[model samples]
Target: MFDLPPWQSWEMFGACFYAVRINALLVLGLSTVTLGELLPGTMMSVKTRSISVELLPSRVFRCTDTFGASSPQRISRQGNPLETIDWTSGDWIAVNDDNGVGVDIFFTLKEAATDNVVVFVDQRKRQFGKFQPCHAKDYIDKLSVCPDFLVARGARFVGGIMDCVSPSNLEKFVVPDDCFILSQAGTELFTALWRIIQRVRLSSPSTRHAKPPSRQCFKAVRKKWIKSLGKL
Candidate 1:
C-alpha cells in the first residue's frame, strides 16, 4: 500500500486545489524519461516518487500533479507579451530618420519550438506605408550612409540629452560622438524617453524635481515596456 502525504492526499482527492486545476488539465499527459529503481525514500514520500519529465524544448509551461510533482510554469496575461515592446521598438525607430534613411522597426511572433519572438529594425521599402525586412548591410550600402556613423550620431543625441539635463553638469555636457556605439538601439531609445520625462519635470514649475518612484504605477508600465526588449 502506498501512503501519500497530506497535500498529495488532498490533491489526489480531486481538482479542488488551484495547482491541481492549473497543471493536470492544462499541460496534459506527461511521460517520464528517467528510470529510477525504488530507493528507501521512494515509497516513503509522494514527492520522492517522481521522475524528471522534459516538455520538449523548454518553453515555460505550468505543470500540476496529484503526487505534487514539480513542473514548469506558463505565463498567462491579458494580451500578447510581444506587443508590449515599446522601449526597444521606439529606440530602433528613433535611430532611423523620417526620410527613411535608417531602418524601419517591425516585430512579429516567430512560432518556432520555443516561440522566438524577434524585434528587428531593417531598412526596406514597402507598399502602402508598410515596412519590409532587409539585411542591415544592404540598407547601408544602398543608401551610401555608413551604419557606424548613424549609430555614433544616435549615441551622441542620447548622451547630450542626459548631460544637459543632469543636475551635476549642465554646462559641460558634451555629447560624445561614439555614444551610439556604446549604446545599443534599445538602450539609446530608453534613455531618450527617460530624458523626456526629466525634461517635463524640470519645465513644470509646480511639480517638484523628485526622483520617479521606484515602485509605482509608471514604473510598472516602464517594466512592461522593458520586457518587450527582453531586458526584464
Candidate 2:
C-alpha cells in the first residue's frame, strides 16, 4: 500500500517552504515515467485499503486522499481532524503568520463531492479583530471548534460562514498544481502581505531598478519566515 499524506500540518509559513520544496523534489525525483508502477498508487485511493501521498507539485489535493471513510472511526464533537486538506477547493489551513499568531480556518465539503461548499471564518478577536489562535488559552470560544473545518464522512453538512461566488465565475475553475486555496482571512492576509512586498519592491533601493526578487527569495522567506529551512 502507498503512504497517505500525514495528518499533521505546519504551524508556520517559514517551516512550510522547505517542507514543500523537499516534498516537491521527492515528487520530482520519483520519475513516474520510468517507474510505471507508481501510477497505480497515484490512480487508486489509499482509503480503500490504502492511499498514496505525493509531495511533488505539492498541491493540497494532489498530496491528500480525496476518498476517506464516510464515517470516521472516531470524531470529537469539540475537535477536528481535517488535516492535509484539498488545496484545490481553497480550503483553510493553519499557518503561523509573522505576528506570532497561528492563522487557521476553512470551509468544508457539503452534501456531495460535486456540491462542495466554501466558508470563511472570523479568526480575529471579536472586539479587536486581531487573530485569535486556537492554541491560546484565552480563545475559549474558538477552542471548542478548535481547528475549524471538518472533513466529515458522507459530506452531509458543513460548518462555517459560507462565501458567495458568482455563477459566471463558476465555469472557470481549475486546481493548479502550484497554488492552494486559503480561507478569506488568509487570502486577505496573504494579499496584504504581498501588497506590502510590492511596495517594498517599488521603493527598495535594491529592487527599484531590478526585477522583483528572485523566486528563491520567496522560497527562502517561506523556509525561514519564522526561522530557516537548512536544505535547498
C-alpha RMSD values across all candidates: 26.5, 20.5
Models 1 onward score TM values of 0.18, 0.20
lDDT of each: 0.23, 0.26
In candidate 1, stretches whose alpha carbon ends up further than 4 angstroms from where it belongs are 1-103, 106-196, 205-219
Residue pairs clashing in model 1 are 23-64, 61-72, 62-74, 155-180
Best by lDDT: 2
Clashing residue pairs, backbone N/CA/C < 3 A, model 2: 14-222, 46-50, 46-51, 90-181, 224-227
Question: What would the per-residue lDDT of candidate 1 be over residues 1-232, giving only the tens digit for each residue?
Answer: 0154443332222111211211221122221111011011111123212222221211111111100011111212213333222222212111221223333221111222333222222232222221112222232334322234333433111111111111121122222221111112122333343343334345533223433333443343344334423420
TM-score of 1: 0.18
